[model samples]
Each structure stands twice: as structure tokens, then as C-alpha cells.
Target: MTQLNEKLTLKQIEAIIEEMSIDGALNKLYAFKEEYGTKVDKLIVKYEKKKLQWEKEFKRFEDMRRYEKEAYSEGVKYIAGIDEAGRGPLAGPVVAAAVILPENVFINGLNDSKKLSEKQREKLFSEITEKAVAYEVGIVDEKIIDELNILNATKVAMEIAVESLKVKPDLLLIDSVKLDSLKIPQKSIIKGDSLSISIAAASIIAKVTRDRLLEEMDSIYPEYGFKKHKGYGTKEHIEAIRKFGICPIHRVSFTKNFTL
Candidate 1:
């Protein structure tokens, strides 16, 4: 019988279980196989599978760290990652974030903010800010989006977010938008938000900030369900816009389906 405090390697544990009855192994593995009722031998195999899964995650984090170091060595002291949210939405503000992460900071589960669960994004958002050197956000209302068009409006939001940062960045890692007017050196990667840790951090900030704005707008327009849709051109939202004939925040250019 293994002592309660006895720690064994996975292989050693499996070999011990194989020498004992399946029932004995099952009883021994109860601590590890909490939900699954597989035989001890099967549990050992399951552990191997889980180990491989975790290894992949470890590699991903390694890659992110490598890239972070490369960005730092380029002599770009404050490299801000810029990204925006609410571009596809019909209402609400287009929000952007610029994050300057600390050189030594590393968060375990950082990824594209869109790929993360809402709870995960929220958790990382806090962790990133607490560990970041500096961060800033910018927002442009739907009125501006409609007047300037989404593409230009998004650039406007991104520029403002970058300029607003207390720590002026020497380099910008933007997600697909190039700022020709800005003096700083910039890299516009198509999916920069997914590849760059700084960009992923920025995405989380922008997403949470924009989502909260829509949630607050819900209080003003209870009938439109802004909190859930975040002002996207949903069927229900289109119906509301049609009946209400557009609110101050509604993007008139995008309301073709609702225009009466």
C-alpha cells in the first residue's frame, strides 16, 4: 500500500498498479481519477494523454516569451500593441487599447482576447494591468463611425489610444492598421492580436472596455438589448432600430436594413 504522503513518478505508479489487482489500483487512483471510473491501468494512460496536452500549452507560452524578448531587443523601449473592438457592431463606440507590458511580466494563459472565454479575458485583463508598465484606451462613438466609416474610424480610435498612453511607445505593433502619419515605427500584422502577447493584452483591454460601454448603454436603451449584442446588427436590434428610427448612437450608414 502506498503511504498517503508517498509521491511516485507516473511510470512507477503505473507499474505498481499493474502488479496489484485492478480493484486495488482503482482504489489507489481515486485521488487522481476524481470523475472517471476507469481501471487503474486506464487511468495511467489517461494521465499520459493529459501530460501531452499540457506540453503543447507550455510550448505556446514559450513562443510568446521568445517574441516578447525579440521585441525588447530591438531597442523599442515602450512597444504598444494596438487593437480595436466593435468594428462589426452597428452601434456603441469603437474602442481601442494600447498596452506596454513590463519586460519581466508573463501571464500564463494570455491569448487572442477573442479566443478567450469572457471570464478568462476578464481575469487576464486585471492581471495584465497589474503587471503592465503602462496602458491606455480610446473610444469613438457610432456617430463618428457612421460619419467617417468603420475603417477610418477604427484608425482614429487606434491613433488616439496610442497617443493617449502616458509612456510614448518607440514602436507600435498594430493589428492590421498602418498609421502613415504617426512618427513611430510600426508593424501591422494581419493577426497581430493573436501572435503578439502585447497585442493580445491590448485586445482584452479594448474588448472589456467596449463591452462595458455597451452594457451601460443598455440602461439607456432597455429595448435594444445592447448588453448582449454589443450593438451588433442583430435581427432584434434591426427591429428596434426600425421601430425607434435610430438613436443618437445608432450608425446611420449601417442602418440600411432598418431605414424606413
Candidate 2:
């Protein structure tokens, strides 16, 4: 250690500290801290803070995996988490996603879609789809939402997502909703998106897919601000409906209240 420290410049040692794990860097840097004074002391403090923060985030991630771990213990090889978005939107389709992730897969900062910003949801959507063993989304349009009603339409969307999965899941972890149409074993966890990593991944996928559709509708209709609110019954959206009346994409059932 003494020989190597003598040969290496302080700048080079700092670079090494930056690259190595906090544990290893601490071991190597502590001896140098007294000699190097403030410079090395600062690096040690920085990475000690980083180490604590990382441990906190990693604990959150592992806690989110509780459901998946239980399923794996039961010999469930593939578990798909299902969640839906846009059921409350006044326009655009209800979208649901089914995602089967590898056992104990780690996605940094994963949580319920509603908890994330648009950019964060978009980033997680891409990463979830890419890493998932099988991922698929189902969309049921405004017309279907009017016909089947939001609850039924959402169920249909979930069924479609599950059916479309390339690799059939042995079990389904749904977010506060259950589809009895499917033969797969299932559990509905209230706020599952917050509780389960798989459900959170699906929530991100479904939300992003629905948001993209609304953005496309925005280009077509331009006046409703679908892109801005994603067709939810915001004050602006309601005002637009009153100003221009409903567009073709507006859910008749949802916007009927605006007309009355």
C-alpha cells in the first residue's frame, strides 16, 4: 500500500476512489486521509453519504419484491403483474399492461406510475419492456368504454393484455382488480403497484402507453389539450368540451355529464 501510494499522484488516487466501490475505496482511502487532509477527507465523506443513500434505495427495492419472492417460493416460474390506465380519462382508450419480469429483477426507483413524473414513467416504460421476459399492452377505445362501461372496458383491456403476453404467466398479480375470465391463478392486491415491483413495472407500461395515445389524439384534435391532461376531466378539458363540444375521440359516457 505504501509503495503504490508513493507512486500514484493524488489526482490519480482520487480517480481510483471515484471508480471503486465505497467499501473498497474507504479501506484504501482511510490511510491516505490523514496525509492528504481536506481533499481525501471530502472524498470519504461524499462516498459515505452515497453508501448510506444507496443502502436505503436498495432496501426499498428489495421490500417491493416481497410478492415475487413469495410466488417463486410456491414454484411459480412466471408471474405477470397487471395494471390499467385511462379508465378515468374523458378521451383516449383505457390501456392495461401485463408484464412478467425475471425473478427478483431490480429496476431502480420503480414505484407506482402515479408517483412518477412523465419523464420518469417514460424511462421506466422502456426499461421494463426491454427487461421483462414478456410484456404486452391492451387498449380498449372510447367507443368500447361507452359500450362496456369503464369497469368492464378495463377488465377487457386487462384480459387482452394477459392473453397477448408471449410467455404465459403462471400467476397474475393485479392492482386492486381481478379478471375471472382468465384461468391463471390470481391475487388482487389493493395498491399493489406500490407494494409489488412487478405491478409497478406494469403500471409504468400501461400509463406510458395510454399517455402516448393521448398525445397522438392531441395532434389530431389540437383543441382538447389531450396531451396536457391526457384527456382526464381537468377544468381545462371540461371547458374545452363545453367550448367545442365533444370530439370523436371523447368518451361519450364520460363527457355526457359536461353536456347535461
Query: Per-model C-alpha lDDT, please?
Result: 0.82, 0.90
TM-score of 2: 0.91
Clashing pairs in 2: none
Q: Write the per-residue lDDT of candidate 2 for residues 171-248, one digit (tens) a residue.
A: 999999889999999999999999999999999999998888888989999988988999999999999999999999
For residue 18, what is the lDDT in candidate 2?
76
Each candidate structure's TM-score, on Cα atoms with residue i matched to residue i, is: 0.79, 0.91
Model 1, C-alpha of 55: deviation from truth (Å)? 3.9
Q: Which whole-number lDDT from 0 to 100 does residue 143 have in model 1?
A: 81
Q: Summarize candidate 1's per-residue lDDT along 23-65 as a digit string, tens digits.
A: 5565667754543334345676665565566677767866765
Model 2 worst lDDT run, 10 consecutive residues: 1-10
